[model samples]
Target: MFKAVGKYVRAVWYLMTFRIDKASESLRMNPGVVSANYDRIIEEKRGRINQYKDAIAAMIAQEQQKKDKLKEVTAEIEKLEKLKAGAAAKARQVAAKYSGDPTATRNDPEYQKCQTAFSDFSSTLAEKQARATELEADLEGLVENINRHKLQIQTQMRELEKLGEEKHDAVATILSAHEEKQIADLMTGLSQDQTSEELRELRELRQKAAAGARVSRELAGLDTKQAEAEFLEFATNSQANDEFDSLIGLTNNSPETNNDGPESTRIPES
Candidate 1:
């Protein structure tokens, strides 16, 4: 018994769920509901697009920052190049002062200072160049990524437009299909439409009204007085017809001028 009760409860739940799902599906098929659902989807997509734009904007800003940093590094490298050239020129001047004495030039503190300055400037320029190269590579990657993201955004926008068109088409198709189904149902005599039912009711009423009128007219004709009146009218018409025939001399009558006699044999004047 317990098992049976549990099964019954499960069946009831299943039936309820099925009914709810069917009702939901029916409501969802409505044009207004479908349109609203599409609108909601569009709004969600727009929100996502806005978020994507924000992210792209951030990437662009970072790319600009990298570009600015690369510019600064490039400028520093140039300045270092100039300083190294000047240091080499100063060392050459010191060597000229040595007048062919290589050992004296090597020991000269001024020459040593020039050498150290050039070495420092060269190292700093190399470091700045490397930094600039890295920044340039970073900028290139960022630009490519930004471009790809922009293309994706454009594609998504086109998809959104397509979705908008699809929404309209879907609604129209659903409405047309619903109308067609109603017509088919009506043709098959399966329609439960209130209008169809009302029209049938009106037709029945009209038929009843016509039948009632006919019955009323038949009952009136069945009246004895009516039949007598018709008979009297027919007699009067017949009398009028005979009088008209007499006036036209179309009636054969016994001549009053005929000789008064019952004799079968009477000589007639030729």
Candidate 2:
């Protein structure tokens, strides 16, 4: 009589904990409502992620344009500097040619021509030098702007990555909750026989997967053997072809013999 009373008490506790309390909780937290909320959160996060990605792409494009502009400015500066150097050299040559001659005055046509050429070259050189300096300053400004944009993009990317991780974790949590709720519902509704049948079906699926894996491994082995056989056959054929070619060349190079009659009737060479 005492053992029967103890068994009845345990059964009541099991029913309260696993069935009644679980049903109460399920009624309190509706699966449809929870799923809707999770979907909304996911959609909002995805929109933010797309916005950040688009901003980063725009920043990258702007940075590229700035870099191209800087390159152009630098090239122009280098070209101007080269031209200035050539102008300076020509001025020096002209000065040297007209130097140490006290009789050669401004009245001399050659000296005047040399002076005009040197003056024009000097003017052009000074103009180019000033333009190069301006371009260098512009290049420096472009570099600074590019660097600023890069830093901004990096910060945004870090934030975007954090947001992505958070979204993934949220999705995982929501999915886990959903699966748990589904399993609880299944347990509440399914009979023992039905549960057993489901387990047997799952076991069969596992067996099929195992068999498929075995077949895949066998097929892979057969493919490897086929490749090896093909390689060996190709090597053997290549070697035979090479030997045949050598034999043919030797036969072709051999001296031709006239066998019109027997050896006694053949003409003898002097």
Candidate 3:
């Protein structure tokens, strides 16, 4: 029931349905319906495309800042750990020096004093080392999290770029069945003038699709010059059509046909 057109189509379905006959006639003769549809699709695609790009940029800027701070925290943890190890080694050296003194009592003021101080220092150093290890682990985890976020952002951006207009058009292919019927009815009852208009719309759509395809290809950085060449070809064709149409209008009020000769051309005759 709801799997044919799109939001835009859904919103305007009534009008389209009401004028179905007229629209159909216009479409058959000019194909302007195709052009209008293309315009809607392209507009939708461009909006989504920009949003995706902005999301990637925002994620990079915001999340990368947090990751940089985590790096600094890791470095600080390492430095503190080295200091703790040095304190432990120095305390052991003093204990060893006093151990060799046979005349010294284990309970003597000096030995006991040194022993008390060293034990306290050792405990403090151990605590610092433990804290540093925990901090290091947390920092490493943070880095991994940031990397995963970065990868996700990049993947989405690439997919969006790749999918482009095709994906967007596909998204909108869910209009009500009634909408299809309405459009069909319109197409069947269209007048010659209306049909010509529809045909014209279709021709314009073909040209835009051709150009948009080129732009998409250029974004992918692949075979771009070919797209440029094709666009140039279409532009030249359209200009020629304009001139031919003017001549036909002056010579005979009737519309000119097949100026481009091949069915491939979009603009009217000449």
Q: Looking at model 1, how many pairs of residues clash?
A: 0
Candidate 2 residue-wise lDDT, 176-246, digit = tens: 88787668876886534576778989999999999998799787797678789999999999867766665
Q: Write the per-residue lDDT of candidate 1 for residues 25-141, one digit (tens) a residue.
A: 999999999999999999999999999999999999999999889888988988999999999999999999989588999799999999999999999988998898899889999
Instruction: Report the Cα lDDT for residue 226, model 1.
Output: 75
Best by TM-score: 1
lDDT of 3 by residue, 52-104 (tens): 66765665565566556556655665665565566556555655777756555
Better of 1 and 2 by TM-score: 1
- The TM-score that candidate 1 achieves is 0.80
TM-scores, in order shown?
0.80, 0.35, 0.34
Q: Which sections of candidate 2 miss by over 4 Å? A: 1-29, 100-270
Judge candidate 2 at residue 111 and give its lDDT: 55
Cα miss at 241, model 3 (Å)? Answer: 59
Pairs in clash, predicted candidate 1: none
